[model samples]
Target: MNNISSISNPIRAPRAAFLGSNLHHHHHRLTILPRRPNVVVCSSSVSTPTSPSLSVAQEANRIGSLSQVSGVLGCQWGDEGKGKLVDILAHHFDIVARCQNEREAVKLFHEIKGATPNHVTYTTLIDGYCTINDLEEALRLCKVMEAKGLYPGVVTYNSILRKLCEEGRIRDANKLLHEMSERKVVPDNGGANAGHTIYNAEGKKFALHLVPSGILNEDTLCVIGNGVVVHLPGLFEEIDGLESNGVSCEGRILVSDRAHLLFDFHQEVDGLREFELAKSFIGTTKRGIGPCYSSKVIRNGIRVGDLRHMDTFPQKLDVLLLDAASRFQGFNYGTEMLREEVEKYKRYAERLEPFIADTVHVMNDAILENKKILVEGGQATMLDIDFGTYPFVTSSSPSAGGICTGLGIAPRVVGDLIGVVKAYTTRVGSGPFPTEILGQGGDLLRFAGQEFGTTTGRPRRCGWLDIVALKYSCQINGFSSLNLTKLDVLSDLPEIRLGVSYKHINGTPIKSFPADLRLLEQLKASGISYEVLPGWKSDISSIRNYADLPLAARTYVERIEELCGVPVHYIGIGPGRDALIVK
Candidate 1:
C-alpha cells in the first residue's frame, strides 16, 4: 500500500494533443478534446500503441492526457464502472488518487461499497484537511470517525497536533496530546453521587451518573476504575436507559472487578449515619458511596469480582449486614431479610457478569497499545475529601490524585488536566460558598443558570465566579487549560461579579482556600471581596467562534484567565456541543 504521507500535491497536467491515423487495414484515429477549463479528454484509436519513434516530450504529453481523461471520467461517473476503469488504468498510472475535499466522498464510498471507511481512509482525509489548514474540519472528521467506532491511531493524532502547534495553539495541542496518552478511569472514589448533564447533537439531554461522558462517543471504552464504588443496580438502570434512547452499552461499558459493591444496605447505613448527626448532617446524595468506601477501607467490602463466586457470597453478605446492624439501633437484620437480599444479589450478579472486568490490566494494556484515554472526573476539586472543606466534602478524593488511585494508572502517564468551571459559581449541597449571591440576586442566577442538582434535584446555592477557589483548584490539579461552561447564563444580567479574594472580619486578606470549616463559615458570612464587570447583556448561545462573542463576554472570559493563570481554551456558550467556542 502506498503511504499517504509520501503523496505530493495535486499534479496538474498540461493541455496537449494526441493524434492518430488509420493504419494496417483499419481506420483508427485518436482525438484530444477540452471539456472544460481544467478538464481534458483523450480518445485513442490504437488498442496498444508501440511508438518507439515518438519523442520523450510527445510520450509524456500522451500519458498526461490519458491521466486527465481518467480523472474526468472518475469525477463524472459515481463508483459505478469505476473499478473496471481503475483495473484498466492500473498498469499505466503509478498511483490512483481521489479528491479529499469532497465532503460526501466517504458517505458515497460507504453507500456504494456497503462497507465502512477504514483507518487509512480516515487518516488520509484528516491529513488532507490538515494540509489545507482546515483544522476545524479535520477535528470534526476525527470525531465522526470515532463515532463510527473507529479509533484514531498515533499518525492521526500527530497530524492534528502538528497542525495545532503550527497555528500556535499549544494549549489545544497539549489537550490533544493528553487525550492521546491518558486512559480515562472513572475511579472508585466516586459512585452515582455526582451527575454530569450532557446535551447531544439533537439537543436531547442525557443525565449521566455512573457512566462517563465518553459514552457519547461510540469508540470510547467507559471504564469504572478500581477506585470507584459500583452500585450494580444503578449502573444497569443507567445502561438500560441509555440503550432505550438508542445508545448501545453492551461491549462499550466496563466495570472494574476490583471495584467495591455499594449495596442498598450501604445506602441505608449512609442515611442512618446522617440521621445520627441530625443538625450537623453532612449533605450526602444518600447513594451509599461513603458507606461503601468505608466498607472497602475497613476490609469488609465486597468487590464486583466476588459476584463470580456465588457459594461464598451469602457468607460475605451476612458479615456486611451484621456490621451495619451493630452500628445503628434503628437498623433491623434477620434471616428473611438476608435471604431476600441474597436472592436479589444473585439476579444482579448474573446481569452484571458481562460488564465486570479486570480494569487495571485493561487500562495498562490500552496504554501499551497507544490508545487515547480521556479521564472523566465525577466531582469538582472543592468536593474532594482530603483537599475539600472538611466534613462537608464527599468521602472520596475527587482531585488529580484520584486518577492514579482510582484507575490504577501511573501518575507519570496522566497528561493535560482541563478543569471545567461554570461562568458563575454554584454549589449543590452545604459548604462554605464565600462568593454566594444571596436573596434576589442569587435567585436570578439560580433560575437563569438552572442551578439544580442533577442527582438530587435540589436547588444549588448560586454565586459569582469565585476566582480564589478557582485559583486554588488550578494549583491543586495543575490544569493545562480551563473550559468555561455556561457563559450564556450570564447574558441577562447587566453586570457580573467575580469573587476576587476573601478577607477576615477585621480586614485581613485570606490568601488561599482555607480548609478550616470555622474560617470558611466566617468568610462565607461577610468576608468575600468582589470585582464587578459589565455583562454582554445579549444572547451568545448561538456563538461557535470565540472571536464572534461580544466584547464584554470576551473580556469576562479573559479576565478569568488572567486571574487564574490558566488559559480558558473552551468557552461553553450554551448546553449543546456546537455552542462551545474554541478560544
Candidate 2:
C-alpha cells in the first residue's frame, strides 16, 4: 500500500488530503478531499508492473492542470512532499514543469529511477536556479548535464551568462562565452587623449578616441582595458554614433570594471590645471585624462564596478567631487550638484550594465584559450609618460610594457610588436621636436599629409622623419617589424630628408635622445644632422605590391630599415583599408 501525503495551506485549508492510487491496468484516479476551491494539485505518475500509474488521458488532464498554477511557484507550506511530486513527474514528462522553492526537488529528479533528464529538463531546472539567484547550483546542473552526455545549448548557457553578467561576475561570463566558442577580443590600452582614425573598406572614415578600431568587425570584442580612464558620456556618444551608422555595438563592446571613471568635474579640473600652467601647459586635448589618472593614482578614484552599488555610489562620488572642489576653486560642488550627478549616474549605470566586464579575466582567458587577440595601443611611444619628452607627455604608458599592465595579460603571451610610423613626422602640441620644420617647408608637408589632429582638429606641426627618435623607440618597444604609413605624402617632393643624428650647441655629436628638456631645447636650436635622400616623386598610392614601388621609394624604405634595424613589413600608401601594401 502506497501512502498519500496531506498538503496543508495555512491561510486557506487546515488540512487537505491529496489522494491518488492505482485503479485498473495502467490507470489511476486523483481525488482532492475537503474540496477547497483555491487548492491547486499538480502531479504526475508512471506505471510499473507492481507500482501505481496514471492513464494517458488522466496524465494529460493532470499536466493540463499546470495552467491553473501560477508561473512562479511559492512553496509556502513546510515539507509539502515537493520531492515526491517531482519524482513522480520526472519519469513521465520531458520537463519537470515546476519550480519548487527548494533544491531537494531538483536533486530528487536527478536521482529518480527511469527518469532520464534531457537538455530541456536540465535547462528548466537551471533557469529556475538562475531565477532564485542560486548560480552555484545552476552551474553544477550544467556540469552534470554535460557529464551525462547532454550538451547544454544556447538557452542553457544564456541563462547562466545573463545571471553572471547581472551580478558583475564578468570573468565567469567570459569563461562561459569562451566555452560557447565566441573568441576574438581587441583591447585598448590608452585613454581618450589619443585618437585613431580608421578607414573602412568603403572609404568611410571613423575617428575613434576611447573605442578600439576593431569595432568595425562584427565578430571582434572590443575591450576598454583597465589602464584606460573612461568618460561615460563620451563612450556612450561613440556607441550611439556607431549604432546610428549601422554598426551594432550591443555585445561587441566591453568596458573593464577595474577602469577608472572620468567625470565631467575632472574635465573642469583639467582646464584649471592647464590655466595655472599658462604657457607651459602640456598640450593635452583637455579631455580630463590627466586629472582622471591623477585621481586613480591618488587612490580616490571610483571604478566602473562602483556603478553596480548605487547605494554607496553617492558617497564614493562625493569624495571624488570634494577632492576636485578643494583643489580647484573654479570647480563647483554642493549638495544639489551631488544630487544631480547621482541622478545622472543612476541612468548611466542602467545603460552601462551590458558593457561592463572583467577585461583582465577576458584577456588572460583569451590568451590561455589560444584565441587570437589584438592589443591596440592608442598613443605613440613619443607620447609615453616615462619614455617620451617630459612635461609634454600623456599620462599613461603607451609602450609594449603597457600591454601587459593594461590588459592584465602575461608578458610571455605578447607576440610580434608592430611599430607604426609615418614616412614624415608630425606633432600636435607643445613638444621638443628636434626635426620640426619651422617655415613654408612644414606648411608644404602639412598640406600634403593632411596633418591635423583627428580629435582636437588642430593642425599638426610637420617635420622630417626623426631616425634618432625612431631608433630609440624601436629599442624601447623591441618591435619585430614596422609599418611605414603615408609614403604617398612625399610624392610631390623633389627630395626627402631624415633627421639621422642630434648635435650639441658646442659642435659635439649627441649619442641618444636626451632626457633633459633643456638639452633637447639646445639640440633643436643648434640644428640636427640630416641625411637627404632622392624622392620617388611618382604616385605610389596605386601600387599594391612592395616590388611595384619606385626605385627611389625602395631605396628610401631600405634606408629606414637599415637605420632602425627593423624591417618594414607593411606600407600604407593611402588612407583607405585597401591602400595598405604587405611586404
Candidate 3:
C-alpha cells in the first residue's frame, strides 16, 4: 500500500492554470474533481470467523478498532476519491466518519458499496449559499446534507478555495484570510484557565484576575483565559443580590422505577388530580425527558400520552426499571460508597411523581395556535449526536433540525433559521480542529473568553474562527442570519489579527484540511498567518447602530461580512441581550 505523504504539492504555476481554461475567465482556475474512483479489491489478511458471531468482548474490540490505520485519507482537492477510498476501507472498518467536508463523501461511500441503509451513520448537514457567486446549488446540497446529518470535512474547504481562486477573488481571498484569522478560522479547515478570585456581591459568582487590574470576574474570565496570575486576592466587589450556584462536588444520582406509577395513578383520576399531588416530588431533572420516550419505544415505558392506557404503561415501566436495577446490582460498583451514593438518587425517585401526557398533542396544539417558539439547544452543534465528532458527540441533536425531533414539530412550521456564533469558535470535547491556537495566545483566548463548558463546567477547547469548519456548520444549520457575539473583546488590544489560509503545512502547501493528527499538529504548530487590523479604543458596548460605531469596528464587521458571505444580522457588543447592533 502506498503511504500518503504528509506534505502536499504547492501550485508552482500561475493562477491561470489552477482553474482550467475550459471555463470563462472568472472560473478559469477552479479544479473540478473527478466524482468517484473505481474500487480495487484488496485481500483480507484475517481469516473469516466460522461462527459468524463473536463474544461481547470481541465485538467491542472489533468496533473500537474499526479503522485499521491511525491516519485519514486526504486529497489536494475535493474530488480526490476519498469516498471511494472510505467505501473500500469500510469493509475492514466498523464505521466511516465525515465532518467539515461535503456530504457526498458519505453518500458516495454507501452508494458505491451498496451498504445497507442501517450501516451508514449520517450526522449533521450544513447549508452554504454562494448566491452572490451562483454557488447556491452547493449550499442547497449542504442543507440536504445537514438534514441527513452528514457533515462536511476538508473537501468543503478545498472546493471553496478552488471556487474563490477560480473567480479571481484575490482581494476577497485576502479578506477571507483576514476574517479567518480574527475568528481563528482556517480557510478550508475547521477546526481555558484560572484566575485570581473575586466574587460578585451575590457571592454566587467569582472572578479571577491574572493581570494587575484586568478585572478577573468569572464572566470576563469565561470570555478569555490566560494572563498574569495572582494569589488569592481579598473579597472583590459583589453584584447586589446575585445568587451563587457554583459547583463544589460530584457524584451520581439514581432514580427508582416507581416514579412511573405516579403518572398512572394520576391517569385513573382523569383530571390528573393525583398527578398534581405528586408533581411536588417529581424531582425530575428534565434530562430524563428522553428516558420517557425510550420506554415507549421498547413498549416497556410509561408516557403521559399513554395515560389513557395507564394499566399497560405502569406495568411496563415497572418491569423495565426492576430488570435494570437487578442488572445494575450484579455489575461491579468498584467502591461501596459510590454504590450507596447512586442508591440515594434512586431512592429520591419514589418521592417524585411524573405527569402522563401525549406531548405530541401539546406540540400539535402549539402548531394550531401558530405560536412562535424558539427551541433552546441544550448543547453546541459540535456535540450533536449524529454530526458531531463521533463517539465524542452527544446523544441528541442540538442543531436547528433538533427542534423537529426533540419537540415533535413539523418541519414546515420552522422558518427563518438564525445561527448564533461567538466572535471566535469553540468546542467542548475532543474532535478534529485544524486551527486550534496553542501556548500563550490560546491560553489568552481561553482566559479572556472564560471558555469553560457551560454544562460540564470543564474548560473548552478554544481557537480562532474556523471559517472552513464554520461554513460547514452554518450550512448544516441552514443559517439565514448570524448573530455574531463578542466583537468587543478585541477592544483595547494593541492590534487585532485574523487567520488566513496557510502558506504550507510541514513544508508543503495546505491545499486542504489534513485529517492526520500528526500532520494537523504540525500544521497548527506552524503558527498562524494573521492579517492585522487596527484596534479601536472606543467602548463599543454603548454603540447601538452599525454605522454609529467606530470606523475600525465597522471595518472589522465589513471585512467579516465579505469573507463569511453572510450578513451579520446582529453584532453583540456585550453579553447582555440589549448589547446588540442589528444591521
Candidate 4:
C-alpha cells in the first residue's frame, strides 16, 4: 500500500516531475482517503446520507467559468476543498485576473459558465501547447484565434519564439522575429529584436464595449443522452439524415457538461466482467456504458468539462485506472498502462471541449427566452432504472422522467411525453422479452427491420409488439403521443401479433407486466397471450400520410392506439429519411 492514498481525497500530490512548469505544487489535503484507494469520491466516515441543499439547476447557475485567453483561467469543478475558496472570492472580481501559472489560470477560466475568450485566452493556450512541444496544434490554434480577430499579444509571440530557439530551430525563430518587426509588434524588453518592446502594444483587434442586451429567443435545441457513448459528428450526421418533418433540428445542440466520459478502459472492463464474474451471459454492448455509470454512481466519474481542463485529469484518471487494474486479476495494467490512458483521454478531452456547456443553464435560459427545447432520450421505458426489470436494465434512466433528472431541468417545465414503440418488438443483449418470436418468424422480422445494435452490431431478438409492456410503460411515462417505428417490417406477413397478456404455467393470468426478473423470465418461458391482426402485403414506404396507409395497416395502428390509449402521431414505414407517415 506504499502508493495507496485515501479514496476520499485521492488527488495525488503532483510529483517532482511537474515542479518546474505549472502543475507540481499545491495538492490540497482533505479527509483521509481509503487505504486501498477507493476510486469513488464519497466520505467513508459519514454514516448518514445528506440531502442536497440546492437543486442541480441552482448549483449550475452559481458555478461559472470564463475561458482563459491571455492568462491562467478559472475554477476546478471538484472536491478537495478548493471550490469553497473560489465561491467566496469569485464575486469580488470584475475583470478576469491572472495567476502564477497556467494551472490556476485555466481553473479561473473554467469556473465561469458562459464567459467568452479573447486575446488572453488564445495566448495562454498557445503557450500551453508550446510547453508540451505540440507546436503544431499550438500554431493551428493561434491561427484560428487570429482568424477570429483576436491578435496574439507580445507574450504570445515571445513564448513561441523562445520555445523555437530552445529547440534550436533558429530559422523558424528568425522568421517569427521578422514577422514581429514587420507587424510593428514589440518583443518583451527587445528580447527578440533590437528596438521597442511589444509588451505595451495595444490589442485593438477585438472590441471591448460592454452593453446591456436583451434575452435571445432560440429555436428548438435537441439533446441526446444515456446508454450510449458520445459520437458528436455522427450525431449531427444522424440529425441531418432524419427527415425534417417540416421542422429541422440541424442547428445548435447543447450537450450536458455533466455527462460522464466513456473511455476505452470501460469497454475492456465490461467484456471481462461478463466473461469472468457473471453466473450466466447477460449480453452487453461492451461499450463501457455500465462501467462508466458505475463510476458515476460511486462519484468518481470524469465529466465532459474534465476534458477541457485536463490539468487535473491525470490525478482523477490515475484513481480510475488504478482501481480497475487492481479489481481485475486477469488484466495487465500499471503506471505505464495508466500513462497510456492519460494521453488517450487527453486527446479525447481536447476533441470534446468545444461542445461542452452547462445544459442546466441552456434549459433555464431557453425557457426564459421562450424557446422550444426538446430533450431526446436514448432508450425506451422498458430500460428505465427504477421501473424497468432490475439486473436486466440499461445503466441509465431512459424514460421521460429521466429527461429532468439527466438534463437538470426542473420537473414543473417537463411536458408532452412522447413514446416511440416499434411495430414489432426487438431488444439487444440479454433481457427477458415476454413476446419474443423465437423461430423463423423472429429471424424474418429481425432481418426485415435490420434489428441490430448500431455500435455493437449484435443481432437483436425480435418479437410481436408487447401491449402488456406497452400499457405498463404508458402508465409510468404518461405518453401524449406515440412514434411507432418499423411498421413496414410487419408488412407482407400473413398475420401480425400483439402480446396482450401473460399467464403463468399454472393456468392463472398475471395482473400486469411483471417487474420481477425471475417471473418475467418464467413468463417468457411459459408464453404470453397475443391478439392477432391480418397483415397488409402492400409496400407502404412511399405513403406520406397516415390516411393513405392500407386498410390493414390502419386497422393495426388504430388497434394499438385503441389499446395503448395514445395517438400514434408518427409512423415509420421504411429506413429512409422521408419514410415516415405523420398522422
Candidate 5:
C-alpha cells in the first residue's frame, strides 16, 4: 500500500527475509495463518499443536523466531521424503529475486511480523520509513508502538533524522531532535547519526580550517582593479585608524606596479561623462574606475610605476590630457592648465614612490617564503564584468578570476577563497534586484545596516538574500567558506523573508540562473518564493561567540548554510573589525 509497490509496504521487519544454502525444514507445509488480528504466523505442522488458535506472537514464543525458521527445520522430525518436499519449495523462498523495471521483498516481513512483533520488529519498520524520507510517518508509528509499551529506541530516531538531513530537510530533522531532548533519548551509537551526516558533509571537500588572524609577517598586500579603486583606500585608512587604536597591520602594504592609477582628474572626467555626455548613464562611482580600466586596455594608461620617471610621465600626461580634452566637451584644458597639472603630478609621484614596487615578484617571493596571502575581492559577483548583469555591470572583473590578472599573481598561488556577503542583499548605484524590498521595509534595512556606498555615499538598494544568485557565486568561486555580515540588521524585523528560488510568469521554474538578463530579471519580477524565519530580539552585534547567538539567528544562519552548501565560518555582528563570531 505504498508508492513503491508491495515490497515497500512500510512494514518490512528485520528477520522477515534471509539468504543461505541447502536450507530445509522437516515440516512439509508452512502455514500463513492470521492467528490474531494483525499477525501472520509461519510455522510447521510436523507436530500437532495443543491449541490451533495460537497467535503468531504465541507461536514465536513457543518456538524460536528467525534463527529457528531460517536454516534446517527439525532434526527430530527429519525424514528424507519430507525434506525433499521442503527442499523443492525452497526454490520459492531461497531463490534470489532481482526485479528490473518491476516490484518485489515484503513476503518474508509478513511472516516474521505475526510471530515476534517485538522491539526489533517496530524499529525495523521505522527504518523502512526513514529510507523513504518519511520521518513524520515513522514518528507516528513509533508513538503507536510506544503506547503498546515497546520502546522505538534511539536507533530508530537517529536513522530517520540522519536521512532527513541528507536531503536538506534539517529543519524538520531538528524538530524530532526537540522531541528526543524532551524524552531524554540519547543516541544508540557514537554521538548521534545526525552528527555523522554533518561530519561527512564537512569531510575533506569542505573541512573548516582556521589560522591565526594577521599571520602575514612580511606585510598585507591588496590587489586593485576598477574593481578596487573605490574600496581599498577606505579599508586601508580604517586599518590605519585601528593602528591608532593599538591594532596595527604590522606589515607593509603593497600596490601592484602595473595597476592603472585613479587620479583626481579621472573622477572629474567620470562625473562629467556620466552626467553630461552619454545617452545612458553607466551608473558609475564617478571615481573614474571604468575610464582608468579603459585607459589600461588601450595601452595609454599611466600606472603606479610610471610615476618614477617624471620626465617621461609629463609627455604621457600631455597626450592623455589632450585626448581626453578633445573627447569630453565639458573639459577645456589650456596649455597653462596642463603645465600646472604636470607640476602637481610630479609632487604626487614623489609621495607615491615609497609604496610602489614590482609587486608581482613580491607576491611570488612571499609564496616561496611560505607567507600567507589573503586577497580581498572587489565588488560583488553580480557586478562582475563578464558573468554579471550586462550594461549595468562594472567595467573590470571582481570575480576570483580577476585576482590573477589584476594582481599579476598566478592562479595557483591563491588559497582559501572566502566570500563576504551580507545577511540580506544590497547593491550600489543601479541594477536589477530580484528580491528587492522597494518600500519602507528596504529603507528600514538600509538605515539598520548603514547600506550606503563607501565611494559615493549613495544609499544602496536593498533586498532579501537571493539563493539563485548566491548559488551562482558559490559555484564560480568554489568558496571554502563564507563570512556573513550585517545579520544584526534583521534583528528588529519580526519576521524575515528569504528568497529560495525563481519562477517565470507562467509559473515554470527557472532550472538554473538564466544568462539572459531580461529573463533573469523576469524570473524575479513578481515570482521568487520565500521561506520566512522569525527574527531575534537580542543585539547580536556585541555577541562575540556564535553559540551565544539567539535561536532565531541560529536558524537563519543554518538555513543559509543548508541552502548554499557553504558554512558561515565567521559571522559579523557589528561594524568594528572585532565584532566577529567565529564558528
Candidate 6:
C-alpha cells in the first residue's frame, strides 16, 4: 500500500501543479509527468534532466552573463522612436536614463500615448547629464529606483558616467561602466549602425556624415545619412556640458551672435534652395550666404578677421569670386559685377568685428553665473546641413548640435531646448515632403498662416502638417517642449487635413523622411494623408490657459500632441510672444 501511494498514486501529484482546469491547450499549454526522487515534469512536455550541480552552474551563468541587450538610440536625427523604447524599457530598469540629449522621445511619446499605464512613472532624460557635475544625485536616483525593485540600465548609467568623464571624471565613468556591465546592464561603446548609402550615377557614393565619440545609452542607435557617425555617449557628454554649464545670474538677456549670423546668412541661401524646390510655386531671396559658406569650406572665404588685413583679404577674395563666377558662368549672377560686390563685403566685414568677441567666452561665463541665454535658430530642422534635405537645405546644424557648435558652450550649458512649429505645415525650399498639400487645400493654409518669410517676404509653399518631419526635428534638437504656433490661423476652416505618412513606392512603409529627391517626389505623389481630427473655430489668441481654449482648439492641440509625440506645453495664438497659452 505504501509503495503504491509513493509510485502510482495520482493523489500525491507534483507540487508544482503541472496542469489545472485553467490551463488552456489552445493558448499554449504545458504538461508534467512524475519521476523518481527530485525529478519533475515541466509544461513543454520535456524534462530538463538537470542535476543539482548543473542547476547551480545555470544560476551562476544567469547572474554573471554579460549578454547584449538593445537599448534604443535615435533612429534618425533625434525623435526616432527613442521615447517609446525608453518607456517600454523603463519597466525593466530602475531609471529611464539619458546623457546630454533631452527626453524629446519621452516627452513626445507621453504626449502621443496620453495617460500612462498605472505601472509606468515619469523619469528625467537629464538634458546635460554628462556634464551635470552631480553624479552623486544621479547615482542616488538610480539607487532609489533600485531600492524600489528596479535595475539601472545603460541609459541611466551612461549619462552619469559621461558627465563624470566630461568633468575629467574618466575614471569614475569607467568604474561605473564596469559596475553596470557586471550587473548585466552593458555599456554602449559609442558606435552607429550602418548608415544609408546615397548612390550617384557618377560613382558608388556614401554619406560623409559625422559620428560622435564616447559611450552612448543603448536606446539611440540608427544609421544616419551623410557621413555622420554619432557616438551617442559622446553626444551625451557634450549635452552634459551644456546642462551643467548653467548660465550665471545676470540681468541682461544675451543672444548668441554667431547663431544670429548663421541664421541671417543661411536664410538667403536656404531660401534659394527652397525656391528651387518650390519650382513655380514660390520665389527665393538670393542671399550670398550659400556662396560665402561654400567658399569658406573650400578655403576661399573672406573672414571677418580678414578685414584688419584688408590688403591681403581681397586677393584671396578675388580667387573665391572668380571660382563662384565660374560655377554660375551662364546663370543670372554676373561674374564681373559680383567681383566688385566682394570689395563691398570687405568694408562690411571691417565694421562687424566689434560685434564679434570670443562669444563662447562671454556666453560660458554667463552660463556659469546662471544667466538666461536663448539660442534661437534661423531655419527649420528640415533645412539643417547634415540631417536635412541635402543640397536643398542650409549649411549648419540648426538642430541641437547647432547650440554646441554655434555657442562654443558645451552641451551641458544649454538647458530646455524648445522646438517651434507651425500648426499646419509649410516648406520654403525643395525636398521630398510627403505632407505637402497642393491645389486649394495648400493654398488656403498658405494664405491663412500668412506663410511668408519674415525677412524675404516670399510665400512659403503650404501643405498639411508634416508629423514625420516634425518628429525628426524634435529628435535632433533635443526639444524639451514645443511651442505650437499659428493656431489662430486654422480657426476659419470648415475642416482641416493633416499629412500623416506616405504610400511608400517600394511596397514597404517608411516612417522617416526620404533622402532621394525623386523617391520623395514619388512618395509625395503616392502618399496618404491621415485626417483624424478637425480644425478649431474660436479666436484662441485670448485664451491663456489650456482648459479655457475652445473644444476644437484644444482637440487640435491635443491631436498635434499625439502626432508629434511631443507635448504642446505652450501654444501660440498669434505671432506675438504675449499670445502664449501655457498648458
Find the candidate with the highest lDDT and give its number: 2
Q: Each candidate: RMSD to true structure?
A: 26.1, 33.5, 26.6, 27.3, 29.1, 26.7
lDDT of 5 by residue, 1-583 (tens): 1111111111121212211111111221223222222223343444332223344355333211211111111100001011111111122221110000000001012221113344444555555555444567667878888898876446667767777888798898889788888888875442210000001111211110011112121122332322233222333454454456444344344445565665666766765655442223222334456666667678787876777888798888888887788888878888898789778777767755565566667656666775434443334466666777665565666566776665566676665565667788875444456777755677688778765433223345677887778888878776766767678888887766667777787877777766765665554445676665567766777775444566668767867787789876556676543455544
Question: Against the hidden reference, what TM-scores do the models get?
Answer: 0.66, 0.66, 0.45, 0.58, 0.59, 0.50
- By the TM-score metric, which is better: model 4 or model 6? 4
| Candidate 3, 1-583: lDDT as tens digits | 1111112111121111111111111000111112122112212223233223233333223212321211122111111112222222232321121111111111111121222211011111111122123344445554565465544333343344445667787786576456546755454322111222223224323332212111211211010101001011111111111113442111111111212222221112212221232222111111222333334345564432333444454355456555444444332223453445334424333322132123344445645764323332333455455655443443345566665554455677665554556666654433444566544556567667666433213334566665544555565676665667677766765444445455454454554433333443344545334444556777788766454566567656655555556655556676443455544
lDDT (0 to 1) per candidate? 0.61, 0.62, 0.37, 0.51, 0.51, 0.43
Give the lDDT of residue 382 in candidate 4. Answer: 66
RMSD of 1: 26.1
Per-candidate count of clashing residue pairs (backbone under 3 Å): 6, 0, 66, 29, 2, 64
Prediction 6 TM-score vs. true = 0.50
Ten residues in sequence with the least summed lDDT for candidate 2: 98-107
Candidate 1: tens digits of C-alpha lDDT, residues 1-583: 1111110111122222212111111112222223222222323223232322333334324323342112211111011111222222222332222111010111001111222344445655565466545689789989999998777756567678778989999999878777877744111211122355565557766665567655655544677788777778878888988899888987878888888888998877766765554333222335677788789899999999999999999999999999899999889999999999899989999998888888889887877775545565545577666776655555666667777777777888776666778788776444466677655678678778766443333346677777888898889888877777778989998766667788887978888888766677666556776655666789989765444567678767867787788877556776664565444
1-583 per-residue lDDT for model 6 (tens digits): 0011111111123321111111111111111112111122222222222222223323222212211211223212221112222222222221121222121110111121122211012123221222224456556656666666655544446557666767787787778777877888766543222111122223322221111111122221211111111222332333343235441112211222322222122333433443333322222333334544555567655443454566675576556545644554323344465556556656555544443344456655655664333333334566666787665565555566655654465766555555667777765433454566655666567767765433222234666666777777776766666767667888887555555555565556676766765566565545454553444566777655444565556656656666677766546675442355544
Alpha-carbon shift of residue 241 in model 1 (angstroms): 1.1
lDDT of 2: 0.62
